[model samples]
Target: MAGVSRTVACLRFGGDDLDPDEISSVLGREPTYARRKGDVWLTPKGLRRVAKSGIWILNTDDAEPGDLDQQVAALFSGLSEDFSIWRNFARLYGGDIYTGVFLSQSNEGLSISPLTLNSIGVRGLEFGLDIYSNTDDDQKGVSEVADETLD
Candidate 1:
């Protein structure tokens, strides 16, 4: 089995009353997924799901999922470097912006550069990780590693 399979990263912004059109206009980029408040959609399993709030997501995962630093760099690419744009967007929309990273691995780990950390901090965005361990024999051990990494 592979120790580390994939690392996906994305920027997600959500609010109770966010307008997808307005967000697109302000960000000058299209979202991978967007849902307005009250929008209803069917899940992959054919289950009906209704959006409780507005959501805009931009997936910035690199084709090569091995390097998190490269993925983060790609995430900020083509986006404005001016912090005011982000600040104004937060003020106008909602401050519920986050960098979502999903890691699928068995025992391997990765590191994000200080530059990437600084960028996320300057944007006032939360960083969230969902780590999935492939090895079922030691799920608890993997969780302990994840906990330590967070701390």
Candidate 2:
């Protein structure tokens, strides 16, 4: 019989004004299933499921300008710290390829984006995130780029 290996993942919701239960609800799971790990929640099963299905959310109370900034900032922070480690760990542990989703409130409306890594320049790395505005008539998108290199 094939063994079912579970992959663990840590979900970090930045900003000082986020409710744990709300985040859990966005994940379509119970709050009890989410355990407090530092500033984020660690869920083995949920993480595995998320790896299989690329779905994520950016929880916000209101779609205000400041709220949008906070959400975007939180996403950038998470990507900078968590994504690299998560990708490396997933590969090392023989897990499937893991992708990152960023959710946030924007001036246009709710936004969702996929985090992607690319190679730019000589031996340099470029991280690109595409932000899609969730609107029917006024569809809009944005991209944030970060370039770095290893010495």
Candidate 3:
């Protein structure tokens, strides 16, 4: 059998910090699950089955090539759900993606977006950004254009 692999993670904002409905209006795609407790869920399956918790980085391996990769957009879309909503989030907490060390600081820093889903092609769209780890250059696991190259 194929090994278990999934690189999807849920964005964990404070419990009372956001309104799921407002997020829905921003992404133009209704969340698979939206609660007043401030959570918006999405997957290619339309709304998600939340089996895990907190920034789950799941990139499935046994499936066929599909938008499972592009579904990263759905997560990004959640951020753009509303400019005001995201703006408020950035203002209240932090902005952009936080480093692993930053997250380990005195406060529970927020996780924000750094990529823009701008281009579209017949093979679907593409994302151009870098995901790096906090380590020396030799130890760097990811860097430059997180397209399907690593996949």
The whole-model lDDT of each prediction reads: 0.60, 0.27, 0.31
Write one digit per residue (lDDT tens) for candidate 2, span 1-151: 2211111112222223334465444334332122222333334234321222112222222222323333433333423243454344233322221112223333333322332112111112222233333333422211111000000
Model 1 spans > 4 angstroms off? 1-3, 62-65, 88-106, 136-151
Candidate whose lDDT is highest = 1
Spell out the clash pairs found in candidate 2: none
Off by over 4 Å in 2: 1-58, 75-83, 86-151
Report residue 17 deviation for candidate 3 (angstroms): 5.5
Off by more than 4 A, model 3: 1-4, 38-71, 77-85, 90-151
Best by TM-score: 1
Per-model TM-score, in order, reads 0.73, 0.21, 0.31
lDDT of 3: 0.31
lDDT of 1 by residue, 1-151 (tens): 3324555566666777788888778767888777887889775457787877777776664323455566667766777777777766666555422332333554566677898878876766666765655544433322233222222
Count backbone overlaps in model 3: 12
Better of 1 and 3 by lDDT: 1
Clash-forming residue pairs, model 1: none
